[model samples]
Target: MNKAMICFLLLLSSPVIAQKQKTVDSKINHVTVFLSRAQIEREVRTQVEAGKTDLIITGLTSQLDQQSIQVAGKGNFIILGITHQQNYLSELNTPRSLRILKDSVEFFQKQLLIEQSQKEILNKEEQMLLSNQKIGGTNQNLTVAELKGMADFYRTRLGEIVIARMKHDDKIKKINERLTKVQQQIQTQNELYTRNTSEIVVSISADAPATVQLDVNYIVANAGWQPLYDLRALNTKAPVQLNYKANVYQSTGEEWKNVKLKLSTANPNQGGLKPELYAWYLDFDQPIYRGLQGKASGVRIKSAAPAMAMDKEEDAMEPPAETTADFVSTVQTSLNTVFDIALPYTVSSSNKPTLVDIRKQELKSDYLYSVAPKLDADAFLMARIVGWEELSLLPGEANVFFEGTFVTKTFIDPNNIKDTLSISLGRDKRIVVKREKLKDFSSRKAIGSKQSDSYAYAISVRNAKTEAIKIIVEDQVPVSQNTQIEVTATELNNANYTQETGKLIWEMTVQPNETRKVVYKFDVKYPKGKIIPAL
Candidate 1:
């Protein structure tokens, strides 16, 4: 074929191109929430022709982080470009609720028009009565009967006009009142509409005729989930039931309906950078010289070493036949733990918190009574659990319950080196504890040029409960840092004593209504004329 003929033939054989822009709407299907942020995932499906086409997804949250937006597809279409734009078009100014209010205002406005017309008619009728005020013409005399009849006619007509005018006035008043209320409602609606920013406009294109499913994901601020726990200890011998939950809250202007929710412990707001330590050194200052005029003169000295930079810092379920159970799936990563809720949930854009059950576990705990006698005479009931790290627990506030009663509130921190989680289940009132100073054994005496001081304390623990209890009493002795002073724990009532921290711990089993006494004596030998603190 010739060149022109070949071009015509190629054009005839080419496929027809149909390029059209289509706006697609998406719904939130999944959300993975962090400590103070969340990842929102929305999906939409549509069909496209065998040419380049634009797919615009609208109605997204305005609190979306533009840099965190990600677009993915599962079809033959390829996303050419994606962008976010906020449009304040007049049509968007009226939300659904406000539209209803406007419709009401229009109805009231029509009533107002009728009321105004009625009022104008009343005014015109009154004016006409005033214009006809002449009772008799200036031409001739009238009979008495005729004059009396004219007066009666004027009285009746004037009375009817006044009554009709009053009714019109009342109707106008009511219409004005209705109008005022609608206006106020509109104002309040407008005030609430300030958060309505334009929707997200995504630019997508397709290559061939196919069904494309696009998934849009973005991070939203002002949304978060916090871990909460209810720790219930029925009895000392029974296992503790730990009901784990999350308080999810958000005000990101997007309501997640029937969406899969996942709570995470990852904090994206805190940047992942370990602060470095810089060497800090001090240099000797050179002596300054005084000037002849009695003025001080000093040379600006620079440090020999570089200056150190200051671093800135669930649910319960019922059993049924052939039932399908739903529970939150716990996933742990290197940095965070996730609780994926299997059931769908609806989370509104209000600041109110929605509590969701994550998981519940019956944990075996060792119950013990602990008392810091030097600080308080009350003994606290404590529970220690091992293998809690596998539970994927986070640091949060926990509510303690014992024997079907509210005990206290405590904090649960999972980051521990001992690998055992310890919780204080409030004070044990049945256990009485007291610490007394033994004055006879504690005295100071002078030996040559040195003073020898002996101090002793006795801790008593009495268990008044029906069952026997194990109590740990903790006290501390003075530890000296100077060579001139000598301190020693002369007598430790069969208790474990640590010389480094001068901590004395007494572990004893006290029978019911039995008192156990622990006595510890410490002697301090220091040079004369020296003061000993906390003696």
Candidate 2:
């Protein structure tokens, strides 16, 4: 062939090539999950020439919130434009562990086949032994020794066959156990690998031939965190140990494996629009006309009548202390606070909550035993914590533990404006309380056109515990809403009284085995024709 012919053949023999854009797969390296939303962050590292390239990143969960998608590039690349698309055609790639599980399943299947073949051989041998129990017809005339030998042979063979069959059955059982485990692993992996993925097509313009690292961030729904707490106090003098934690749940279809996780208290799902008050409008009620059954009779109305005498006794109707010392280490920003977990975690897409420890703090508090005899006969143990606002705690359920024992659960609301946070730990069974009416000081009489009723009550408290304790005794006096009726606290017995809420507080220290008494008197005067619902 001539040189021109040879050159043409060489060009023709060369492989046909087409221009294609650079594509790379980026993984979720970090996640900042909020109370109601999660922000996924990924980084792509690749070398790009001095030209334009389209980087197609796949393997993102389909539950991504499209509007929150953001893309940025580092190094010598400029991010031109970005777009998101659902890629149902993307293949679900199994992880290394899943691949290993597949191998394990194949191995177990092979073992099962071998075990079944052995079992079939054993069955055939057993059948042959059972069939050979009868000898030829000529052997019937044999001697006693010969017949005994034949019987012995039959017995030995049958026993051996039974033992072999049992051994085969045991092997089969063990194989089945392994097979069951392998099948379960396969099923779990299959479920995890069955989800479709999303793609982020990022248009990039490279400044030069260099490695460009692209950071992709997006928000996904159905992933969030909530606060949890454990409060434990050993004694009244010791500080309380508070452990703050977060329970995170996600079902975003992509497992976050060994990723840096952060929990935020900000809720993006909350209404962002400022609330506007509407005009309050009221109107008079409109009457409705209805026929009574088939008759057009008017509805009868009942009228209230004055009581002639004392009515019979009616049936009884059945009815955060803040620590400022970093309960959880938080990174406060302009909009939200974040808790960056120190340890990496793998939060699967199973929607099961995974608890992560935020921080622990020993908070100083005052312990008080309080009794509200008017409402409940039991005395409760409470802890008043001051300067709790420094902890930056969000409202959450707290599990209270006293003296190494789990007492009860109480909610801690940080929005409360009280200077001191009062937490009711649990009921104090060591303090006995009783409230009874003082019959000698109680009287009911009528003067002219008005009726007056006076009542006195005594509250007795005893400290049965061996140690001294701080206690607060509480009671209430009624208030009159009608102008014609008058109500007064005739004798408060030096108790701190608040007129706004009608609550009387008696704070005192009780010694061991000490008994204390509180007395209060109240009187109500109303018109003779009017009735007071409660006295």
Every candidate's CA RMSD:
13.3, 15.8
**Model 1: per-residue Cα lDDT over 1-535, one tens digit each:** 6899999999999997765778877878989888888988889888888767777676665677777777778887667777787655422234565678789889988987887788788788878878987767788688999889988987898888788878878887887898899889777655534564645554555565899888788888889988899999998898888888888998776767799878887776764555545445555785444323322322111112122222112125664332011356666555667777767898766546888888777787999999997888789998987767778787899999998989888888777536677878888789998889999998999999999999888888889999999888899988888999999889998888898998888888999999888888989999999987766
Tell me, by lDDT, which candidate is best. Answer: 2
lDDT of 2 by residue, 256-275 (tens): 88887777777777634455
Candidate 2 residues lying further than 4 Å off, grouped into runs, are 1-19, 91-114, 138-140, 159-190, 253-255, 271-329, 341-350, 362-364, 374-378, 415-417, 427-430, 439-455, 464-468, 477-490, 496-503, 522-535
Q: How accurate is candidate 1 locally (lDDT)?
A: 0.77
Q: TM-scores, in order shown?
A: 0.70, 0.74
Which segments of candidate 1 are over 4 A away from where they belong?
A: 1-19, 90-193, 196-210, 271-326, 481-483
Candidate 1 matches the true fold with a TM-score of 0.70
For model 2, name the residue pairs that clash: 322-388
